[model samples]
Target: METAFIESPLGITKIVGDEKGISEISVLSEGTVSKKIPPQLKECVSQLKEYFNGQRNQFDFKLNPQGTDFQQKVWQELLNIPFGKTISYLDLSKKIGDVKAIRAVASANGRNPLWIVVPCHRVIGTDGSLTGYAGGLWRKKWLLEHESPSQQQSLF
Candidate 1:
């Protein structure tokens, strides 16, 4: 696996993957390179930059996230979450065809290794409040604000 670090508005990010696909992308306070950046990773980094800049909405890079089959199913559902939209964990649980598994769904979401690309940040509390985010609640708030339909004028 190859890894590279890039600075994002949310924080420093560490991207890890290989020829098959990207395995992980997580936020970090600082970078520690255990592997060199590969050609495929360069493309992923470029696409990530475009995403953060709001120049791109969909990610086209390959991915090979590691997790249980159930977790993979939940993550796939997360991908269906459109950009600039939010879904409650309970809603996601239903969409996955198991309303009783809301906690399991949330747990899978927490384990999402791809971060923004997988869009785990789009999930919120059932009461429309921001909730658990692996990166941080502040970053989650900032991401939602960034993707909100209302522009900065609302705050102004």
Candidate 2:
């Protein structure tokens, strides 16, 4: 697997993947070393840039997130979350057909290795508050703000 760090509005991001597909994309607030960009990572980085620029809503790159079957299922459901929409962990649990698994659902969301591409940031607390995010609450807040149309500035 190849790896590289790319600076983003939220923070420095660690991207890892190979020819088959992307395995992980992690947001890092610090402790990142710059490395050579791999040719195979070009597409992933391009799509991520588009996403951050608000030019792309959905990603088209292949992915191979490492996780348990349940975690994969949870992450797949996360992809269904719309670009500017949010869903509660309870809602996600119901979508997965396991209402009692809300905590499990939230856990899987926290474990999502693909980050923005998987849309784990779209999951919020039942009370509509920002909650657990491996990328830190501040970055999560920035991402939510970025996706909100009301928070967007008019360039015109």
Q: For this target, which candidate reaches the highest lDDT against the unseen true structure? A: 2
Compared with the true structure, what per-residue lDDT tens digits does model 2 show for residues 48-125?
989998888889989999899999999999999998899999999999999999999999999999989999999999
Candidate 1 vs. true structure, TM-score: 0.92
Pairs that clash in candidate 2: none
Q: In model 2, which runs have C-alpha deviations exceeding 4 angstroms?
A: 31-35, 152-156
Best by TM-score: 2
User: Over the stretch 1-156, how does candidate 1's per-residue lDDT look in tens digits?
Assistant: 888888888778889899999999999877654345578798889898887887777798899999999999999999999988999999999999999999999999999999888999999999999998888899999888877767424575
Looking at model 1, report the run of 10 residues with the lowest lDDT sum.
29-38
Alpha-carbon local distance difference test for all models = 0.89, 0.90
Candidate 2: worst-modelled 10 consecutive residues by lDDT: 28-37
